[model samples]
Target: MAFGKWVKQCFESVVDPDKENEVAELTQLLQAGIKERKRSFVLAEVLQDRVYKQRHLDQARNGIYQRYLARAWADGRVQESELEILSWVSKCLDIPPQTLRAINLETARPKFAEALAKAMDDGIISDLEAAELTEIARAGGLSLPNFVEKFFHIEGEQFLRGIFAAAIADDHSAVDVLEQLVATAAKLGLSRKVVVEAIRPQAVQYIEHVLADAKEDDILTSQEESTIRQLIETFELPIAVQVYIDEELRELRLLTDIKNGKLPSIAAPPGVNLKAGELMHYHGDAVWQFLRLLKSGPDITEHPGVLAITDSRLIFRSLTRSGAFGFGTIVAHDSSRGVIEVQRQAKPVQRFICHDQSRIPAAIFLSALRMANQTLTSQDDKRRSRHIPRDIRQRVWQRYSGRCAECNAGEYLEFDHIVPVAKGGSNSDVNVQLLCRNCNLKKSDKI
Candidate 1:
């Protein structure tokens, strides 16, 4: 059955003729009966509540906890990486923090102890073995703690190979290794000196691969630029990040002037009507994929734009190139098991992970989004531009070539408020940059 029809039926119960007439007459008396009935038929809330149950939440915790222990014990002992995941899971889940902490010490006893016994038949964690163990820890969702971030890369190359192994081959034949290399550098907080040294030895392939990847994507992401500058000095690249800018950023590079205060403000996708200052909220780096955004209805397929968080809604900005996907926003939240569920009628619930300090509480953001979305029909629409204009959008976009500010991806380029509107920042160009759908979603609005 069609989703909209099925949804309509879910809210409808078979009523006797007398009951139906009575409901109709009562609504007529109030004069807003139909409106009231529509509100009660909301499908987002009903489906969200049913999709996740207490059992599912508890099971999810148990599962991750077990996987955490296995990865921790892989090294014959729980190390910092495993310890950090426990800490993150603590903050993410509703369980007592102590329970999660205790797992660190406990993982060693049963699993590590047994593994030690089995390994005794041979030997101990050799560098190769320890390196492999590290790789396993990374694969099993290691959330490296700050203290461990840089120091953890002390065994940089080896550990990097371990990480790369999980994602792709560790072969040194080409620069396509650029993707894995940058990802590892960012994750382990590899020092610039270390990062340069590592790439220098592999420069032939690294440079070749970087150029290839750049051409493939057509631009370097802000994150990619940051990584590149770490390798070479700023104002040093002649070819430009894209437009060949030599100044700190594009305006200087293009030698083009920026109309300081004339930058564009937070934009709503086509078909969306925005009340000035209605969009405000913070977010962080997060992983995202093309979700159909609907489950029950005839598959709505994929939408062409990216989604954003405003003070009162989850906004969808469709792509400008092609793709007829629709766009708009809705808001709400529930953090039952490290995930926030956003209820949207006919749209599959949007789930975001909040397992790291880099992530803001979904509930907090959702509440603000809900209140902001309500402004569409409320006195809130009269709000003046509470957000200021930095007028730096064009400058930043030029820096990255209309790609995601982080990954430099071309599709779903979106404007992200550097400091979220909810955090009391402006909707101006200076406070925003163009981010690809994926990077914008992964970045923390708070961080």
Candidate 2:
């Protein structure tokens, strides 16, 4: 039979003591009606004034407890006052403590379990539901956790998981949310280990998101590093996760050093010769494209070679031809796709394309070129205008809607020279444009 149907039948089988006459008849007819009708006085008189056999009284005691349980739970909840009344009724009728408990559990345990399920339907237990659950537990003569444990041993763990998840949903570092999580877990009688395990998955995801954002620019700023460090401490992240974050930070620091012109020198390639004090910054396999003007069209020729950037110049050596351009002689350089195009004074632009157009070579080459140019500018007395004034910067940002010109991307944007400063580009509004990291890197090999 369905559980609901059985509960309904149990409540309907109430027996009344006022109508039962025979001392033998009383045991069978006396069921739930005594408590439902508030006739505990009549039951007391029947037991005290009338003479009945001991076995009959024992049987009658069981009937009275069942009827009292049915009446107390008739409205789908048992109140604290009803529990007190049940205790008084049991004492007056001299029902054994074990017998009374057995009757209550048999009749009320299923009802309490069903009610608890309903209260947790929305994954929350409200104040009213908590009070009601407490009352129902008392009616069954059990504590709240003990009462729930009777139905499901892991209910407290499930509650902790749900509470922790909801608390950290918005801001994991929120003090109030943390306090609430700890308090709720304690209330459920859960340990610190269980609470930590429940929240670990979310904590890992949050840390990963923050780390990804920090690495997006290819350099970790001091502020970003500080924020990530604070998060790790706040969450008490495990060593396994900390190791990954540390590796990313190390790579970012290297990139930061490269951009700041602290790039380390490497051994020169076989065909490359360094001038006095010229340290090789980069050397790799590359394809060099030479453009020639002809009647039919602009003829293009490709040659495979090794391209090297030193502290002084860019050198490309091929089996057929070799050329070198000192930083002082160069007018401008630009990059697109996989090619770096250098225009020298009174010479055709030389385009060197690196393998796969990797950003590492591009970054090293740009950093070396920039540092060399800075040295030239500082040694020369001819003042060059390179700094963009505040007004021009504001105007350019507004005109571009703070997005890249090439890709329409909005992140990692930079102010670029339409004609590079190395090529005599000005800081005027007409020459400045916005480009995202990828577009800027493609245009000038700038990280």
Best by lDDT: 2
Residue pairs that clash (backbone atoms under 3 angstroms), model 2: 15-32, 32-67
Candidate 2, residue 303: the lDDT equals: 81
Please report how far candidate 2 places residue 293 from its true position, in Å: 9.6
Q: Which ranges of candidate 2 are over 4 A from the true structure?
A: 1-208, 222-247, 289-301, 329-358, 375-447
Question: What lDDT does the true structure give each of the candidates?
Answer: 0.42, 0.66
Worst 10 residues of 2 by lDDT: 377-386
Q: Which portions of model 1 show Cα errors greater than 4 Å? A: 1-230, 234-264, 267-271, 280-309, 315-447
Each model's Cα RMSD: 34.0, 11.9
> Taking the tens digit of each residue's C-alpha lDDT, what string does model 2 give over 172-207?
543345456655544434455555666655555444
Highest-scoring model, TM-score: 2
lDDT of 1 by residue, 190-267 (tens): 554455455443342233233324322234455544444543442122344423222223321111111111222355
Tell me the deviation in Å of residue 438 in model 2: 14
